[model samples]
Target: MSQPEFDTYATSPRTLTVEDLQVSVGDHLVAVNGVSFQIRRGEAVGLVGESGSGKTLTCRAVLGLLPETGEVDAGTITLGEGATAVDLTGAARPTWDRVRGARIGAVFQDPGSYLNPSISVGRQLVEQLRVRGGLGRTEARERAVELFGEVGLHDPAGVFHHYPHQLSGGMLQRVLIAIAVACDPELLIADEATTALDAVIQAEILELIARLRRDHELSLLLVTHDLAVVAETCDRILVMYGGEIVESGPTEQVLTDPRHPYTRALLSVATIGDWSRRTLEVIPGQPPAAGAQMPGCRFAPRCRYAAQACLGGQVPLTEIGTGRSARCVRLDELVTDASPIPDRIEASA
Candidate 1:
């Protein structure tokens, strides 16, 4: 059966693009290696990978949230459409300050971390409006209350006086969403946005994000390891391994008929449509520690099909089909009925 049409991640004209993005911690370990992708206005893109696969790092690079030790060593990050574009990698700090939360907004894993405990949720939101938005205090306060209501919060007026500790996880997440969408950014980076919430809250948060994107025509880059979530939320999917994109394409094609071994292995571990068994499957071996230099494919250590030729120079992204590519040396070699990429998955756990 064909996968259901996912309009949430539907394609639109490109708004943001990253090319050859290489982020590193000092001169040592490179956290994000030659990462590149594009997010079109109103389209949702999912960046899926194991923890430390550089998904978070890649998102942070755009938000200017890289740690003190980290830096964008190479590549270009362009935001905006047509002639209005800004190069994020080369732009000044003041430029990023202007872009952040205005042209580009971010919703991260922990709302608590960004929320001010000492202040009322309404007050802090007003600050964002006044500072980034340059609204007067009264106008900002009114806007904040309206935003609370917009996010489906009950009693937006009362919630305005409530502090961070007063609201439930879901409510707090809504508040964060309110702040993120306050300025109507062109691109919203949701880095593990729902990861900290409970299963039910997770669903609510994702649905809220989906609704916001739809209603506001917001572009989104959802960062998460949950294939199930990505499958439900994203139109386009990018699979990452060892700080590099292994495979990327439409959600259906990549999930059902993965081209890269890593993509297939990731699907093997994620419980998708349920080929149930007594035991669960997992990708063997951890990713290489940060900064570890490799002569060939970084995933070769964990890749089941690793051969003598696996360890060479950097594997290039090979186009398997239109707008689809995989950074696997043996993409063609593995594309056969005998390869058992999907067959094994369908047959076993």
Candidate 2:
């Protein structure tokens, strides 16, 4: 049978296109299965999911950071503008090397892992400026200091001179952001970039990224598990379950009225309010193993309203409302009789 055309969901005229991307570990384990999304110029897209839901793996594939054990089994990852797109799935390492930190920047989950322990933060930032931004040593130094200030690091000069270990988690995260945005990349991928910080710090980091995107007209792809963060920052949100996107729509619409069971389950956990009289709802089982191959919807096993049809064949993403889509067999039932999640899950942390 022929595959369905994806142009129907190509809502953006962006330089980045992830078309049916599939990443697997060895021959049997698939971390990401047939994921498709687009990142347009000057827009922010959020990929939200529970742990092991392929959010990070999807972003890593785009950045060419998939482990050596992993491979892009199917699909195309196109970058840049025009009708002609760069096919990055099985491309040479040098091709992605040229674009990774230059044209496309990435802010990883932990800043310390990315930073060299021996080098002073200033030197690291300067090196990125020199290599990625193509600036002279003196010019790079100036830019590094300016970037430090931009990311809200205190005593920019002093922090620059200190090593990564000397800086706090929040400070290191700022430095990572500085390095990622050094060259003013056209696209930025932040993978749980603020997960380690406190609430106040996370807010600041989110605001910083938002401001940077607006001021520089940058396209952002944020991978996170926080629904609140997506609501606050992203223009469009994709909800991933198992290894594929289960639902996607404008952030506000998706949050306000989710059409997928998995999405509703996720929002149920993330949203906090009064929980005194209600029981918290949690998705019963863990995500299926990456090694486990299955037909139909991977989420069917855990879905409360799943039918035999859900396991009979592949489920297609169907549009439920304007600019909204969900991959479900009983999408109409799920939407019409979507149960009300409790006002509060657990008390706000």
Candidate 3:
């Protein structure tokens, strides 16, 4: 039988397209390498990797909210398409002011990091609604109450008046979520949105996000290090390593049938650790730091199947199948079993 065609996902109305995005810190560190991906309307794509893999920086680059000293060095960062497509690459502050909260909203990892402790949650939400949504104070407050209810906050009016510090982490996160969607942005970049909450609260937050996506038809770019979270929340997965996209595909295929050694190594930790009565499974070796001069596949140093060719030079991305891609030199011979991971690659944790 002929091999199944890999380019299976048909085109849709894309909300955001990030092409060849490069991010740097000052003039030294290249935090995000040439990363490219698109989030179509109503789709949820997860960016997963170890910390420092450039997931957060990529998200920051899209909204022009990079931290001090961080900047997008090259490539196109466009929102929408065709005549309406806004090229955000090095866009001015005025353009960012209009596009950020209005066109592309975000919910970051920590609510306190974004929320003002001095201001009431209701006031903040109202400000966003009024400024971004162009509503009157009364209308914005009313809508804030509605959003509070929409995010599953029981005491909408009461919660609105309370300050960020008064509420629990989960509650404050809900408030942030409400602000993120106040303008009904086409794309919501949720970077580690559930990281600060407890397990039960995390589940609740994830469920709320899922419900919002289904009801409001919101597209999401969720960035996290947790594989399980991505499996449950995302439709597609992009695996990042050493500041580059190493593999990408449908979540089900990528999680259950990964073609990259790095991906398989990640899955092995989850599956084998759960089943094993013996040693735990983990991928050893640290990812290359940002700005490191990598002459070959960055993952080659840790990969169990790396050959001499894998270390000689840059590895181009290989289309594996069914909208999947990986940057492995031995893509055809890779395995995704939950058997014992090699001792050399077992993480120490």
TM-score against native, each model: 0.92, 0.90, 0.92
* Ten residues in sequence with the least summed lDDT for candidate 3: 1-10
Candidate 1 clashing pairs? 29-291
- Give the number of colliding residue pairs in candidate 1: 1
Model 2 per-residue lDDT tens digits across residues 1-349: 1111233325546858898988998765988888998877777888999998989888878888888888888988988768546677777988877787788888888999999999999999999989878899999998899999998998898888999999888899999999999988889999999888999999999999988987988889999987878878888889998889999988877877888878877876775333363666788888998858787888877776667777878798888876689998776555444466434322112
Count of clashes, each model: 1, 0, 2
Model 1 C-alpha lDDT per residue in residues 226-325, reported as the tens digit of each score: 8888888887889998899989988877887888888878877888777475577888899987788899999988887777677878899888876688
Where in model 2 is the C-alpha error above 4 Å? 1-12, 83-85, 272-280, 337-349
Show model 3 residue runs off by greater than 4 Å.
1-9, 271-280, 336-349
Q: On a 0 to 1 TM-score scale, where does candidate 3 land against the true structure?
A: 0.92
For each candidate in the order shown, give its overall lDDT on alpha carbons: 0.85, 0.82, 0.85
